[model samples]
Target chain A: MGIHIGVDLGGTNVRAAVVLENGTVERLLQEKTEPEQGAEFTIQKIIHMVENLAEGRTIEGIGIGAPGPLDPHRGVILNPPNLPGWDEVAIVDQIKAHFSVDVQLTNDANVAALAEARYGNGRGFSSVFYITVSTGVGGGLVLDGKVFNGAQGYAGEIGNMILNPNGYHYSNLNKGSLESYASGTAIGKRAYELYGIKGGSEEVFDRLKNGDEQAQRVVDDAIEYLAMGIANLTHILNPEVFVIGGGVMNAGDLVWVPLKERIKKYLYPELVPMMNLKPSALSGDAGVIGASLLTRK
Target chain B: MGIHIGVDLGGTNVRAAVVLENGTVERLLQEKTEPEQGAEFTIQKIIHMVENLAEGRTIEGIGIGAPGPLDPHRGVILNPPNLPGWDEVAIVDQIKAHFSVDVQLTNDANVAALAEARYGNGRGFSSVFYITVSTGVGGGLVLDGKVFNGAQGYAGEIGNMILNPNGYHYSNLNKGSLESYASGTAIGKRAYELYGIKGGSEEVFDRLKNGDEQAQRVVDDAIEYLAMGIANLTHILNPEVFVIGGGVMNAGDLVWVPLKERIKKYLYPELVPMMNLKPSALSGDAGVIGASLLTRK
Candidate 1:
């Protein structure tokens, strides 16, 4: 079987892994992205990492997952919001110029979805909708073992879905977007507003576990909106399984038990049995693992 | 270059058409369904219509679009709410036994989507999401010229999507479902409640054209909610084009102009140009025409 290299590129860090055809990570390494130094510096760092990982082993292809709004077809990283000085960089061309092998690029969420569907909890599922509820809520759909990219490669932008037209107004998005209520950023903001405490989503979950009434209210609202968003996707896609990942899911039963109950209330009686929600099995490595599978295309 | 037959079965009427491979209707006929006569009688009537449509001409396959909750895989019409006598009726097997030809069965909305994707405004588009906003709001997705039937064949049940949790509650569906606010039946009920006038959606439009303020309010509300529903789908699926049909669309500019303007408010700035909403071209014959295309699978 051929060997492959997978790269998970983010604003804060860069990671690369050598993976086998059977979706196993053979060797992995991580380093700071240091985006302040610019795209050329970052690109060289990535190439160096891949070269070291490849060593004497023959690598057939390389796949990279980047924060998106990038053109996957053209292989250019457009102006992604998180990574500074990485606008319209020909990452694919630059990497391919040195590697002498295929290089594929896709959105981070999309690669994670592919990884989960192929190697994690969704391995047996033909259709999977993967949702990440961290800093911002994002999602990707894997249908029939392939990423279902809609027109313009902008499908699965589920976080932008409206949950309440009259709710909070985010400057970047419309009022009451799903992300405004369910994302980790939203939870932290709500907790700060209600109790005048500046803390992360983990802090809010801790307060809830300690039976803080205000914290409980904040978490309950997030669960309700998240469940509503999931139910809406169920109506449209009816995927075999919904694989949820992200830092917020670390709340575990505090989110899952109530979320499943809320989802049932919104779904059709007949569709209740079809609504299968599972926690993502790959955790932090999903990005690199999924990036590797991009070469399969 | 082969001929196929398409059947559109409804509670009140049955329509069949001979369709060419290029998606043209060669010959068409319609008659009362009289479903009260029972499932066996309806099946026999359908067989008779197909025989007449064939008329000694060689046909490669047949496709039937039925009111759903039906099993497309097993080809069974399972206890649809509208068809009282259709309880697990093996329509496909019975028809195939008589004609010895390939027969495909799918939900009415899905078949309509298929027809529109093949022959209507979606002809040049790669992905199309078709929506019908008449007595009820229903939708179907056609991706790469094929109907995307998700897990258990219940995909595209967009009517069941909730727009407002505290709004109207239907006995069969969750509160504030899109159908509760946008369907023709909902429009009529709202019209009666507001003005004490029991009238159809056409009457409401007529009143709006004549400058009745109450009628205008009802329609404007419907248009707003419909746009919200479309915008929700836009954020999730991001299809190339959205083709809308059904009796409500007959209001034309009253719905189209506001729907387009309102949808823009909810979409991402970059995605605004990609949102293409078109009126359905096949009109009343979409069901039958789309059914015929199902055999293309």
Candidate 2:
């Protein structure tokens, strides 16, 4: 059994953890990313954190989950939107040179999906499509226990998939993108527009539970679009399970029940019975743990 | 180098071929499937064809491309819509029992994609999404030189992907499915509705070329929807290239030029430069050659 190091590199913070072969966390460390100090400083901080964590341990390899537009094969982190001033940094090579260990890099969402597929609700499934309905819709596809990174490592960019090209237009994506309809940000925005009350997705869900007609309408609409996106995914991927995560999924049954019912309306009759939709079990630790699993044989 | 036997089993006919390791067709045979003759009769016909092809020759294995909804893993031909009585027939077991060679089965579209990826225009690409725009739109995803059969071997059913939930209804798929908008069957039906004339897709293309306004509108609408579907596929899969085949693609520049331009309008700017679209190079031979390639070591 080999021990591995996993790093979740986010815009606000960098988290590192030492994980055992059985998917157990041995030690954890967190620190501010401080991207304002530039790429060199950030890289140094990550190296120091990993060194401290591995001081008395035998580690096989390291995996880092970062925001994309990255060249995973070349180990180069391209200009990610949130990580300012970190343009074209060869983070894997730098870390490998410093630690004398193998390093692998993938997008954060993909790592989270890998985590779910390997250790969470999708543990026994051979294929899993993990979707995060947070501020923005993000997806990760795990096929045969491995991340299915298509050409250029941009396979699971499902947020940009157009749900209705004639619907509302988003600046970054085409009209009626899944992100514009199903994401928490989209729900919040739509809720505010309809009721003239600005609130997050949580507040909207609360209002729906209290039987607010307007809120119910807004949430129901989002659920419908979410189901549409999931149905489209089902037709394309036919994964064993769809493991959903993110802040909005915290609404629990309010989200899953309607979502499942709506998905059934669009799926192939033969496929409706095969649909296995579940909530994420690992929460925030999924990215770190999944990243570490990248180095696993 | 090994010689292989490839069988293409369609509703109306069965085609078998002897293929060399280099993807060259050495011998070919064609016969009516006559599926109404019963499953045992069809199995015997396939066995006889394979024996004829393998006479005085050494072969590695046999590969069959059949209408889907079949179990590729167990090699069982489920009751596909076209093959009326093919109710869970173990095609692989029967073929293997008759001949002392391994046998593999996959959906027809997937095998065609494999042929394109391994021996056609997609040879050097690591990922390929092959779409055939015949009577109904069908898709096959070849990732890392293999078919990406999802959990139940239903991975590349892109025809069922929804383009508009509010648009025209199709019995076999959800309302406003990609197939409903872009398939040849859909195009011809729309042309008939618009002009009160019944004609095939090729006749519509000819009318459009001959400066018929109604025909132009019908073809343009189809092109727009097809481009939208391709764009959605691009966002989700981001394959290295999109290899298009089938009769509708024979319209050449009228289809490809407008399609390329329309897809560019929907794709992310960064991804625009990364798009590599091409036409299938192997013509109708892809299915047989691809099925044979399945037996390659």
Candidate 3:
């Protein structure tokens, strides 16, 4: 088999890596995506990055992980807010035209899920639900090493999962959604509304580390909703393992210890003992690595 | 090919049937379970039923659907409230001693899910999530025509899914759990508490048919929570279809019409147009039919 090329195309940057058959990434490239320049420009830049990374080698297949609101089955990008001007851009078709290799596309969270299931914290588990709690909450499910994208490619859209019908209303998301209360943005907003603190989650965490009481309350409240969200997922899907990542999780022990303790309250008593929650091990590389692994399926 | 036997073991009675390879039931037998007589008596009773149903023909396999917390992997029953005095019954092994055919065990909900996936409203869908809003809410997931039991066999435990932390407290379920707010029992209890209507869901529905305002409010609130639960499941799983059953749905248009309308408010706009929620078709026979299907894998 020839080299598998993984592409992580984000609004800010596009990355490509030549991955070995065993899921190792060697040669890599990174360039500005400049999505404002339009889908054609970004698509051409991605092709340039992939070509440069492959270095004349016979390319086996290419996989790209981008923002959602796209059709994976038809390889069409349906105007995701993050990718301005990409109104139904056929990314896969464009890439396929330039190179005689199979091209596939999926949301970023799904790509990360596949990577974690194959070679990260989710390794060895038969089923894994990967969650990202960064700017907005997102998720993906990998069953038996295959990404289980739901009927409309919107399966892992957990950020919009309503937790409190009367809770906060964030943009178009449902009121009291997990993302509205537990995401980094949510934490920062709550902190500002409560204390007029100008900084975001980073500033709030710093204050918590300094033993600030208000910050402690805010952190505790965020973890509480996050815990509820996880408990809901556990009851609904019961995946073998949950591999979580994102800016909120980066708070490390502050979020982890409380998260593990709080989820137990929502789970059935029997499930509390054997719950398998692990921090994602691949870190930021999951996007590119997961993209490459998608070609294997 | 040999014949397959399915056993549905409930608190009040036991049902056995000879199911054709195409998921059709040609003959069935029903008898009192009398589980209070203890595990040995019930095991022997099941053996006699199987033997009678098989009529000395070559038995290909046997499958049993019973109340849960049963261990499907080990074929053990772990003291379900429905099967009292059954602290730990090695059901599969006990049945296997009298017959040489393969034996399998799974929860009643899971068996029903398999039945609906193969022969009812969920047929032809690659993934189906089945929900029963009876005295207590429960659920099961069938993916690619196979029961997608979660890691510890708690997958589809939607009864305990938390929707409102400050909502309601029903039995041992989480406060504001889906079951606490939306199950048939919940509807009856709410009716009794608010308007002294004492006949449970059946009475409430009867009153609502007369256009009782209190009854309408009770029904509407229950449907609201149920809609939230469905929306949550949709955002997380996005299965191809949802097959719903149980006594509450028997209210027909009174429940179905508002439920279809309420769930739309919580879902993403695009998803509203394609939500495929259907009433379960097989009814009471699903248990035996689905149990027989367990052996096909």
Local accuracy by lDDT, each model: 0.87, 0.87, 0.91
The digit string of per-residue lDDT tens for model 1 on A1-297 reads 557899999989999999777888889999999988989999999999999998967778999999877777788888877797678999999999998899998889899999999999888988899999999898999987888767766788888887777787654876888998999999999889878868778789888889888888898998998998998898898888999999889888988899999898888777887688999999688888999988876
Task: Please say which candidate is ahead in DockQ: 1 or 2.
Answer: 2
Tens digit of lDDT per residue, candidate 2, span A195-249? 8758777788889888888888888888898899999988887888999998878
DockQ head-to-head 2 vs 3, winner:
3
Counted clashes in each candidate structure:
0, 0, 0
Q: What is the lDDT for A103 in model 3?
A: 93
State which candidate has the highest DockQ: 3
lDDT of 2 by residue, B1-297 (tens): 446999999999999999888899999999999999998998899888988888857778999999878878889888888798779989999999877788999999899999999988889998899988888788889888888788777888888888887888865788989889888888888888878758777779889788888888888888898898888888777889999998888889988999999999888776788889899999677778989977777
What local lDDT score does residue B183 receive in model 2, on the 0 to 100 scale? Answer: 85
Give the candidate number with the greatest lDDT: 3
lDDT score of residue A257 within candidate 1: 90
Candidate 1 C-alpha RMSD relative to the actual structure: 2.0
User: Alpha carbon lDDT of residue B98, candidate 1?
Assistant: 94
Candidate 2: CAPRI quality band: medium
What is model 2's interface RMSD?
Answer: 1.2
Q: Each model's DockQ?
A: 0.71, 0.74, 0.85
List the pairs of residues colliding in candidate 1.
none
